[model samples]
Target chain A: MFEQAISAMASVVVDPYLLGLIFATTILGVIIGVLPGLGATTGAALLLPFTLTMDPVHAIAVLATIYVSATFAGSITAILINTPGTSAAAATTFDGYPLAQKGEAGRALGIAVISSTVGGIFSVLILCFAAPLLARVAYEFRSPEYFALTVFGLSMLASISAGGAVKNLIGGIFGVWLSTIGAERVTGIERFMFGNYELYEGLHFVPIFIGLFAISELLVQSKTVDKIIKTVSMKAVKLPTLEDYKKIWKTILRSCGIGTFIGVLPAEGATVASMIGYSEARRWSKNKKEFGKGSIEGIAGAEAANNAATGGAMVPTMVLGIPGSGTTAIILVGLMVHGLRPGVYLFTEQVEKVYQIFGSMFVANVMFMLMGLYAAKLFARVSLVPTQILWPIVFALSVIGAYAFQGQLLDVWLALIFGVIGFFARRHGFSVAPIAVGLILGEMVETNLQHSLKMFDGAWWMILTQPLALMFLVFAFLGLCGPVIFSWITKQKD
Target chain B: MKNIYLVPLILSIFSLAVIAIALQLDTSPEMIVGDSMQARSFPIFLMILKLILIGILTFQFYKNNPKPVALEKYHTWGSMFLFLLFYLLTVYTDMFIGIFVVIFLMSILWGERRVWVAFLTATITPGLVFLLFDYVLKIRFPRGMLMNLYYG
Candidate 1:
């Protein structure tokens, strides 16, 4: 097995075309990653169709490269502009932009790049060494376990719902409801089509994701564009001093750990990982007051966690045929399209392919770090481009990307519709993340719940029968309730 | 009366109505061989949950009596809407014409009213997209009638 893995990793041919594709796609991913509204998932989704004709290995390499590099690249905008390029980078802006404002932008960028590289490399290594073991563990998960896991994921709404506990639950429940729009999964029943044939297949994720993230953001930004004073000058970038690095070492370590853990959980994407890492870092900080104001630790924790989350997310994706995040779910589609099934069998059966993927991810991380260091100043200048020119280009790409999804005009129309919906959602302070999370987890929750119920003759006790399921249920519940509990405790103390 | 909350409330209600209609059409079975539950189970569960959430949210809006802050100025909603409308119109039209015109018009909408700049953007953007998507990526786009004009 080790020999096979080694040979597979070693045999990855770095021909000129492959190298060029990797570099070009990695750069493209970085550019997309730097755009606040576009994320790794959107980047991957946009680029996915282009790879359909390429060799499966090459396609996997390109997609993996984009996925890995884009994950790290998002921190650039977050740190530089204080606007998170992807939801995952939200925590980075907590400290990253502040550091940029203080003229230590270079240092913050350097550390973010380095720590991200480290976290990514570390996760890849873990993936390499522990994939078989992890896959074996994943194999043990039954329907009940999966059902519990989905429940646990939904429990995360406590942290996500901004208005109140009830609001969050309502949002999550709404999300699960939305997932049911397509044709029935079990009995092939066509529920809720309203006689529109388009409704028969149910709501496509591409439209919903595009609507919630891109459209909603545009709407919100439209409302607040006046308040969005472009703050920093693009002139004279600064790097972190030695002292800054020394101070943030602990934060980087803690955040990497946090991110990795969050990443490992199925359906919890990098955004949640970064948020948790940032919040935890703040909680554990000796100088918590310095956090949102511009602490290096904040940037370090967030960037490290978000980057590390990519590797963590891949854990379940490559092992259990279950994706840990929305982006990975799309990646799962790509993997399946390439005829690669994600499971423990993949490691034993397609060890070479797995190794090659792992190897490509490592290379992508290194490339991102190099590009981030050498081209920080150039990328930062993107901010100087007026929204007038920039937005049109973005709109054009959005249209092209939407069409490219299935080469269908209908998808473009769907994207536009979603864009409008997204715009309004953003204006109302309703987060797109929960909607996304809901969309991703909706099917998982429903399917699993039904399966678990069947196993126990429709009895709820089956959920608690399996130790793993119970543990996940408890953990999810705690995760959901933790913020509220903490808030109440703090309030009492005060 | 603050009407801002009413918008989302109405939207949510509309969404629920759509969902309810969709659910009614979902007459699929409850189980298949390989997986645990039937096809309709998840969707039905989700629809029911959405109904409850929408109902609660609508109620919350009424109960809370949330006030509307003045919508921020400078957002060119009309321009944005026009841009979207033009984009949809272009989809049915010739690809080159659609791409060129939308780019030009969107540039104007975004406040780049310069004739030269608009002309440059309209032409260059499609050219670049064609080169990238068609030539480099090898993904064929809808050539529409422009295919006969250019290739034939």
Candidate 2:
């Protein structure tokens, strides 16, 4: 296995095109990542169609490069603009923006870049060395385990819902219901199509995601168009001072660990991992007051965890044919397009290819660090671009992006419809994340639930009878309800 | 606020109506894998859920009367109208020419005061897209009249 891994890494010869592609894609990923409301998943989805005709390996490399770099790139905006480019980077904005406000923007960005690279490299190494063993472990998992994993993922609702428990539960339940739309997996029934052929496949995630993030944000941007611009005009990019590094090293390590663990779990993606990491980091910090106010530690913790989560996300995707997050789910589709089934068998069946992919991720992580350091100033300048110009360009890109999907005009219509829906949802205060979560996990949840039901002769208690399944169910319940319970307890005490 | 649930309630009903209409269309037993359940079950379930959620949300809206979050004010009508008009126009026109024209109009509407900058952006944006998506990435876009007229 070690030999195979080495050979796999070695086979990735660094040619000019590969290097150029890596650089270009990473830079593109950074730009997309830095833009508020456009995240790694959407970025990957937008770019996926363009990769349809490319070499599968190169496609994977470019996408992976973009994915990891974009994850880190989100921090740049979070620190400078108080707006997280990706949901995972939201934690960074808590303290990062504050630090920037106090003229420590350079240091915060530097720390973010360095720690993001470290956390990313650490996860990639694990992916490289431990994928086979992990895949073997994952192969042992059954429907019950997946159901449990989903439960655990849903538990994150407790942390994400800030409005109130009832509202959050409503949102979450609505999400689960949304997942049940389209065609029934086991029964092969089309439920909600309203006679439209497009409803046959259920809802396509691209339009939904674009609606949730981009469209919703556009609406919010419309309302806030008059806010004074907050651009960081740093004289020079500041690297983290020695003392700053000393302070954040522990937080970085812990967050990376948290990120990787959350990432490796099926269904839980970068957003959850980052949120959990941020919450935990805040809970454990000596300078808790500095959190959300621009502590470098907060930025480091969130950035490190989010980037590490990418590596963690890939673990299950490479091993179990299950994606932990939306981005990897798209990647799983790409893998299927390449005629590859992701499972333990893949390690043996496509060892070199797998290793090369992992190896390429490592290279991408390193390249991001270098690129981020050099291009920080240039990217920072993007904040100066007026929203008037930015929104139109983004809208144009949306049109082109929608059209690029199967060259269908219907897709453009779909994007517009969803964009409108997203805009309203954002205005009204309903979290768009759950809607996306519903769309992505809907098929998996229904199919697995049905399959498990059949296996247990339609006894819902079978979820409890199976230890692994029961454990996961408990975890999910805990995850979803934990925050409400805690808040209630706190309220009572107060 | 009087009809907080008016939009969603109506939307849910419309969705159910659409689902009902679709059900009248030809569906096969092959479409139904086993038992009484089939591809239609999920959609029906979704419609039902939407009905319930909307009903509950409506009830909650009346009972609690939650205030609408303060929204930022902007000249959204102009932008929205322009976007809608452009989108409709593009459906009938060629994508390239339509896109170019729409972008120019949008930039102007977006208050890009500089004519030279607006023109340059409008022209170069499509060119960049053509080069990137068409030339480099090799994505075949909607050629529309341009392909038929120029290439053919």
Candidate 3:
């Protein structure tokens, strides 16, 4: 494993071509992340078509670097403009904007950069050591266990803080139904193709992702095209004094632990992690009164946790077939597009590929930290780009991206159709993330259920007899009901 | 019914339609195994589940008495219509031409009165896209009438 890790590092980090790709994508990521509403998921999805002809390792590395760097770049907007570039950085604005208002934007940015870098590197190390072990354990999983696991994954979406539980579940089930549109694998019989040849393979997820993430956001941006962004001026980022670090180092470390754990949980991501990190930092701080009022600890805690989540989110995505968060789900689609499947085989046979991801993320974290220190002012200027101009370009790119996949014009139409649906769905207070989760996991759930049923001679309920499957099934039940139960308990207490 | 009930109402109607379709799926020997679930079974089950959830959601909204949202801005709908037009143009004409025209038109519609910024964006974007996708990646777009005329 050590030898493979060294080889992976040498190939990914030392190779000039890969490094240059990483550097360029990281800058692109920074720009995307600094612009409010264009988060890491959209960036990765829009770029996925461009990476179609590249090597699998290099393709994934580009997406991963973009994910890592974009997550950190969000803090720049949060600190300077009081607008989070991504939802993950929403918590950063609590203290970040206040610091900027106080003429301490540089100090706030410094703490954010340092904490995010440290937290990101720490999570990558954890991902490196932990993902393989988890994959090894997952090797014992069979059809029933996998069915239960996917069910548990779907159920976990009920607890997502976005939209509402019932709506999210409905969206997930709807996505699963969408996935069932094509011909059945075992039977080779069409279900809902309606005689269209393109429907034979079901829907391509790339166009769907581009539509939902990129075009939907474009529709939303249309309303605010004339709105201007107000930014706090900073000539250059200033490094935190050693005394300042002395105060925030512990908070940063604690957030690193908190963020990684939350990120490892399915359906949770950096947004949730940063919120918990901020609250927990305040919970343990002696300067609680300073929170939400230019507290460096608050900035450190939120920034560290959000960036750390970019790495921690990769563990389940690579180890299991399940995605860890919304962005990782998009990354999973990117991987699937490249004919890469996540499981024990990927870890065992493609160990070098997994290590390449880790190395890329590590390099991305360090590179973005350096970039943040020197060139954040330039990146921050990206937010000032007129929305009327920026969004049209994004729209064009999205169309190209949708078309570039398979060189099909039909895919572009599909993207536009889904984009309209996505706009309406968002307008109605529904999160589009759960729909994606359902689409990605729907096949796994159906295939594994059929396998499990066949193995038990059509006795589907017999799956409960297996201890692992039973445990996961029980977890699935609890996961679906856990939020309702917790909220009830809180209500009772009140 | 309140304005918000349209969401659940539409979802329920759609679910019923899909379930009706699922019920009619073929159950021949080739498509169906001995006792295992068929392809339609999963979707039918999901539609039922969605129907039940839609019921819960309707009840929740009823209990909460949610307010009706204001109409969306003209620009939002205009942008979407323009985007649809862009798609049709690409389908009928060329993608690059579609891209250039839509960017310019979208900018104008969105109140970018500065002609130079709009034109520069419109021209430069397609140029870069052509250079990158056509020149570098070697991916050929379908020839439109204009391209056919030029090449021929």
Q: Best by lDDT, which number?
A: 3
Error of 3 at A299 (Å): 0.7
Residue A455's lDDT in candidate 2:
68
- Write down the C-alpha DockQ for each prediction: 0.44, 0.36, 0.71
Q: TM-score for chain A of every candidate model?
A: 0.85, 0.86, 0.98
The reply for model 1, stretches above 4 Å from the true place, is: A12-16, A77-84, A93-103, A161-175, A195-200, A215-245, A275-295, A449-464, A481-494, B1-8, B15-44, B54-76, B136-140, B148-152
For A436-461, candidate 3 gives per-residue lDDT tens digits of 88999999999999899889989988
Better of 2 and 3 by TM-score: 3
What does DockQ come to for candidate 1? Answer: 0.44
Ranking by TM-score: 3, 2, 1
| Residue-wise C-alpha lDDT for candidate 1, range A209-283, written one tens digit per residue | 555555445545444333353545444434557887788788888887888888887667688888887888788
Docking quality band of candidate 3, CAPRI definitions: medium
The order of the candidates by lDDT, greatest first, is: 3, 2, 1
